[model samples]
Target: MSRTESVDKGHGRIEVRQYRLSTDIDWLRELHPEWKNLGSIVAIDSERLIGDTTT
Candidate 1:
């Protein structure tokens, strides 16, 4: 597993993003063989804050 993150602040707003990756998907490949040569999985998470609101 690996992770990375980024943040940006501008125009009175702040944005944050996170990324994750994993190559331990052998079980997934075994369960679903249709995904040929599947090597890795990735995910992204994000958040934003503007003024007094967060989403």
Candidate 2:
């Protein structure tokens, strides 16, 4: 099954892996140089936003 995840941009940082299929990782990396590491998986929206929180 397809999976989705969100990586919060802490403070001035930027989101991490698991972005939209159209998103370009290289571009994102250039945009946020502060974030040396990828953020944690925030959610998996089963085709859409499921709720307000995730495990």
Candidate 3:
């Protein structure tokens, strides 16, 4: 199990982001031969106070 955390404080607001990854999924390499030595792939967006503000 792996965990990560990030925090940003500015613009009169505070933002925090967290992530978790797991490699317990079986039959991962069989389905995708490109992913060797990799259990899985995960992607996450940004969590911020600014959203479409154009600032």
Query: Pick by TM-score: which candidate is best?
Result: 1
| Candidate 2 stretches greater than 4 Å from native | 1-24, 39-43, 47-55
Deviation in angstroms for 22 in model 2? 10
- Backbone clashes, candidate 1: 0
Q: Tell me the lDDT of model 3 at 18.
A: 73
What residue pairs clash in candidate 2, if any at all?
none
Model 3 segments more than 4 A misplaced: 27-38, 41-55
Q: For this target, which candidate reaches the highest lDDT against the unseen true structure?
A: 1
lDDT of each: 0.96, 0.45, 0.67
Off by over 4 Å in 1: none
Candidate with more favorable, higher TM-score: 2 or 3: 3
lDDT of prediction 3? 0.67
**The 10-residue segment with the lowest total lDDT in model 1:** 27-36
- lDDT, candidate 2, 3-49, per-residue tens: 55766545444444453343235555667787546443233233222
lDDT of 1 at 46: 96
| lDDT tens readout by residue for model 3, 1-55 | 5778788888766576777776765677877777777856554445766655422
Report the Cα lDDT for candidate 2: 0.45
| Candidate 1, residue 19: how far the Cα is off, in Å | 0.5
